[model samples]
Each structure stands twice: as structure tokens, then as C-alpha cells.
Target: MIDVHMDPQVLAGLQEVMEGEYPRLLDTFLHDSEERVKALRTARGDTQALRQIAHSFKGSSGNLGAVRLALLCQRLEMASAGDIGGLVDQIDREFAVVRAMYEGELRRVFVG
Candidate 1:
């Protein structure tokens, strides 16, 4: 798993655009994440839907500075073209990380 760093440089760039809008952005990410997860779950027998949902997830994560998650999603998206049975656990784990990160960031911005 790639270490998704919320380094100064990365956060600086995200902060530049996010600014006081972090909460909204975080909400968007959360909504998108949930939607993607649901799509992925229901897409078990549909390879195309799986690929598309993964791709969409990758885009959303990238937009939120989640490079690692985006990469994982991209990998899953590509792997969906083949057999996805073996990748389920890994994908679920990564998705958990992404969800936690998003939630944590949101909490920091809103509660701190």
C-alpha cells in the first residue's frame, strides 16, 4: 500500500484551493466515496460497472489529494478487467483507509 502523505507540500496545494471550503469538499468526497462503495458492492457480477466505479473513485480521490487511494482505485479499476475475486479484500482495506482519512480530515477542519 502506498503511503498517502498529507505532507505540507501536498496539503499546501490542496489548502490553496480548499481554503475555507474544506468542509464542503470533505462532504463531497464522503458522498462520492459512499456512492462508489455502493456501486462497487452491487457490481459484483458486472465487470464494466466495477471498472467504471473504480475509475470514478480514483478521480474523486485524486481531486481530494488522496494519491495513494487514487492509485489503488486505479489499480483495482484495471484489475477489474480480469478477475476481481482476489482483489476484494485489498480493495476493501484501501477503501477503509480512504474513508478514515477523509473523515479525519473533515473532523480536523471542522472541529479544530
Candidate 2:
């Protein structure tokens, strides 16, 4: 409902993509988001893989309309050089909220 990161064009594109296999899109988002979160959980913020993970999540989430989570991912990416332990928990929580909301809406639109 809140198209924070997704503009009308993006939403339209998403709708077109989901015209047939909507469940697949939802599954992909869930799986990829989980992987990104797991990467953040284990990342020590010094490795290039960690930075890549954050950047990937930021771009992916933004494309999927999870603006807040994408922003957090950007922050994590930017702050990857520092001790991100404390921010990890916060990011996880926020990501979860966005994930849930996005899933709920996705279901409503696609599965309803």
C-alpha cells in the first residue's frame, strides 16, 4: 500500500511480471532477503563479501519496494567499515517488518 521505494512505473512493471507466476516472485524475494540478512548476521564488516551483500540487498529491496529496508541496507553498506554489531539487530528487526508487510501485500495482490 505504501509504495515508498517503488514508483508507479516500478509497480506497473512488477504487476506485469507477476501477471502469471506471482508466487515465484514472492518466493524469490523471501529467499533473497533471508540470504542477505544471514550474510549481514555473519558479516564482520571488513570483507568485500559483506559489502557486496549489503549493496545487493539495498538494490534488490529498493527494486521490490522495501524502501526502508533498502535504506538500512545502504547504511549498513556505508558503515561496513565500522563495528556494525549493534546496528545488525536493528537492521534485522526493521528488515523483518518490511519483509512481512511486503509479503502480506504481495499475497493480497497476487493470491487474493
User: What does each candidate score in C-alpha RMSD?
Assistant: 2.3, 3.5
Off by over 4 Å in 2: 1-12, 45-47
Model 1: per-residue Cα lDDT over 19-47, one tens digit each: 89867877877787877777777787788
lDDT of 2 by residue, 1-112 (tens): 2335434466558868878675577668878888888888887645577668878888888887777677777777777455466556766887778777667767777666
User: For model 1, where is the 10-residue window of minimal lDDT?
Assistant: 4-13
* TM-score, every prediction: 0.81, 0.77
Off by over 4 Å in 1: 5-8, 80-82
Give the worst 10-residue stretch by lDDT in candidate 2.
1-10
25: Cα error in model 2, Å = 1.1
lDDT, model 1: 0.72
lDDT of 1 at 18: 71
Question: RMSD in angstroms, candidate 2?
Answer: 3.5
